[model samples]
Target: MQLFSTHKLRNIQAQEQAIKKHAILVVDDEVANRKVITSILQYEFIVLEASNGVEAIELVQKHPNPESISMVISDQRMPHMSGVELLSQLAKIIPKSVRIIVSGYTDVESFIGSINKANIYKFIIKPFERADFLWTIERALENFELQQKHDTHLLSLEYIVAERTKELADKNIELEQAYKKLEDISLTDPLTQLKNRRYLDKHIDAKVGLSLKAFQNWQKDTTNPLPHNEQLTFFMLDLDNFKSVNDTYGHEYGDEVLKSIKPLLETLFRSSDIFIRLGGEEFLIVVRDINQTDAQILAERLRKTIKQYVFVVNSYTNFSITCSIGYVQYPYITEQPNALSWQQVVKLTDKALYLAKNNGRDAWVGLSHLNNNINENEITKLLDPDEILTQNNTINLVSNITLTIK
Candidate 1:
């Protein structure tokens, strides 16, 4: 253990000796003062002497590297540009250089002022004790080395932190792209790339909740005049005899037919309109702030457009499809407060869709006629499969009929 301890102590001493070889700059106009300070520091540090402040500044500027000249000790009252003036200039040029001022009793006040301006680290009085002066130099060099090490450590830490932050930012961007891909997969219809029923349900639920809240708030404020026009129309739609096309031509052709129809539907509706493929040949449309007449005209136009639209599978094979539409206008449902729920509005539109299908394969039916039946509780109940539109429309069945309502 003693032998190992001796080896470790020798290694430490060598490392310290290498560090002490780093130089110190001593500036004093008095030759004797410079000699005394140099002799005291030379045993532990490499000492450089300057006869005046100008020479001190020149030596310090020449030694650009901080490790070369660790500290500067100068007399406050020098021939030209005092120690404080040289130090103040040095402070701006090399902020890390530690500065100490040596002064006599007469120059104390001036030294104090210099201390504040140049931020001199320490001061020593003239006629100083040899031990005190030596100790002060040692302490100043020690602090200078410590500060250098601290600055180096901080720079290393900043570099590591900057690298880590960049890595994290890259990871966040990758995650966002992954999330976007997932969202596209979730909401898109694989065949047509249009929004699917699941997306429609989530979006409509939020919109309906907002609309209901707004309506309720407006009702509470009876003193304010009502808006001239306020109504929401739900249009339900279905492709006319879509299964027949699937049966006559293959399912591949049926898929082609659905794909062909999507662009037309998208063109017919405004961007603000919500359109969705509810599955198979069924679709739903939600149009905001439209009157019953406009809603009916819109539904009729869609039905006519689909009927005229031809689906061509091949150069020789051409087929045509029609649509059945049903719509219900809200605020027409009931005059009673909280009279109509969003589900009931949908149910009434579904009922209208049923009537359209019942009347004929390709036609539009309006549910303004059924407005009397809508009450808050019943409208809420319409969301329940059992209480809403008949199972014939609610149940998903592979059949020959096409129906749609918005």
Candidate 2:
């Protein structure tokens, strides 16, 4: 630990003294008793003396700020009103102020009736040691400062909650607009709440057409557009051996496992991207306006996330699941954006998915691009056995299984 200089120590002492500057009220019918308590506390705190419970209340009311009085100490027996009654009324004016009562042994019987009613902090018996009295005052002031700090923190948290609520309301409005577009067609799956295959079948054509148009416009512009932003990428994900889940556990548990994938998909893709449940445990994600490299990174991340996730079926059963992913980018030949039909492109992506499953599960395979020299006939040959394309170097392959493709 480092030691502070004398100058620095003085500054620290000044800050502490500033924080302790709060008024404390002392109430008693006898002038001698009030003087004794005032002399002990006057050096550390702003001490105010009151002749009785009635004068203490009047003094507190006439003060410019009631909150400045951090604590109140009163004798149990007093004229005009009792200590408990005075503190109870002061509670309404300064609810956070710490209250303490000073009473004699004879006054113990009255305390049993009024302790909770006054919300007293602590009791000081008559003929107390000076040291113990000062210690109690220090503790009561600390409690007062803590309550003030807590109220300040609560106000800040309330403001943060209000801001977050407004943001959630705006997101709900966006969802409402999306729901209007789906009004004409029933597109949601009963389980998982992701779009069903029917939604994809109806919209994939328009999606592809729009991507092709954007690519063409990007190519013609003299001012170059960002690289890889024109590609339309798709990911095909299937849980490895998901049927066994239903067999070992019930179908209800399997349904829960499927529902869990919705959030995982949302985590990896943007809201603008389309997600589809192509029946069973297979999911399709269409991500637009992303580069090929970033799309490949997302596919690998999704595979790892599924592998590490713990699927809780019940209190007794918990298991981890893994998935295989295959992805492809549209305009397989960038020069010829429409060289292959959308159906043909999907077929190629499906082939990659099988490749990942065959290589061993919990991995991703991507068909990044095809050779520029390949003709229409050669393209057909590429599919009979995808290995031929890999052998001939007709297409680019990306996978976590190998650093190089054959």
Candidate 3:
């Protein structure tokens, strides 16, 4: 009989080795109960013994990771702490581990609380059936393995999502940089390095908002008498006879002349001023917080500087250039309302530019003189074709004069 029992035990041990060892921690103050439980599970599982809650807590802390501890089995009655208490502490350290309680006392309330709070997986009576105990432990180990697999899958998904998010963010930043580079190329004038007309149209609304805010602030200060000179000015300057330069000296020389004039204009004005190239031979200047006189002075100074600086195209060729300037100040005719619209101011300045071209082509003109002439009939007549120019001159008489001079 001894020889037969030894052979059976050896076969069981060989089968246990073929399967992976599941670790189990048993907590009990009674040495006999702990020995019995260990003996029952030792054949299939690697059993660890803990005499009380303190020892169980230390064991759980020592092997906190789920792969290290498969399950925990504790007795309800102990010296320092109860089974429920030990399970609750273990739940904090290793929440995924399976927990079971073996109790002789039939206190239903505390047992229910333990199930609710500590998430106990199973409960066994003091006198447990051998087959039932073995089946319960096998079931607990299976559940534990399933939970570990689920947790691993969740971790892998989180990692993949994090990596994908970072890649998208980097691509977004690259796209924004590419867009900004294209915008810079579009808004720049290649010859003069100044802002082109497209930039002006895109930002005009923001400029209008700023002007409105300034007008509102000026209106609010009623006690302080505002000066007549505190108003926005718009200056329109055009190069005189620019087409002649391109026709006489080449387009390249004309481009050089335009490039040279930009710096002189920028140096004569304040940094708060905005200067823009509104196409060939035309420029617009927006000077804020300046009165009509200061704007006119600035324009005249720019004109004089250009006239004095004789531009040399190359080693042997040189020429002189001139400019025509027209300006208009806001609040042209102040009414009882004490406010003027920006559109009206721009119209006045445009009219002033037309007058400056008609006056002599190389002087400055202010819109104050044309304020009264901005009536409905005059505006209608100005738009009429018959009032613009006539082309019925005698060419035969001019040819005769030219022949006599020759």
User: Which stretches of model 2 miss by more than 4 angstroms?
Assistant: 1-185, 218-227, 385-391, 403-406
- Cα lDDT listed for each candidate: 0.74, 0.82, 0.72
By TM-score, is 2 or 3 better? 3
- Tell me the spans in candidate 3 whose CA falls farther than 4 Å from its real position: 1-22, 40-46, 63-67, 184-186, 213-224, 227-230, 260-265, 270-272, 308-320, 331-344, 354-362, 369-406
* Residue 268 CA displacement from its true place in model 3, Å: 3.8
TM-scores of all predicted structures: 0.75, 0.52, 0.74
Predict model 1's lDDT versus the native.
Answer: 0.74
- What's model 2's overall lDDT? 0.82
lDDT of each residue in 44-118, candidate 2, tens digit only: 888888988778888999999988899998888887898999999999988788888898845566676567898
> On residues 213-300, what C-alpha lDDT tens digit does candidate 3 reach at each position?
5555666784655544446677778888999999999999899988986788778887666678888988877776766556667767
Winning model by lDDT: 2
In candidate 2, residue 265 scores what lDDT?
80
| TM-score of model 2 vs. true structure | 0.52
Q: Name the runs in model 1 displaced over 4 angstroms.
A: 1-23, 31-69, 103-118, 124-139, 213-229, 332-334, 369-406
Worst 10 residues of 2 by lDDT: 384-393
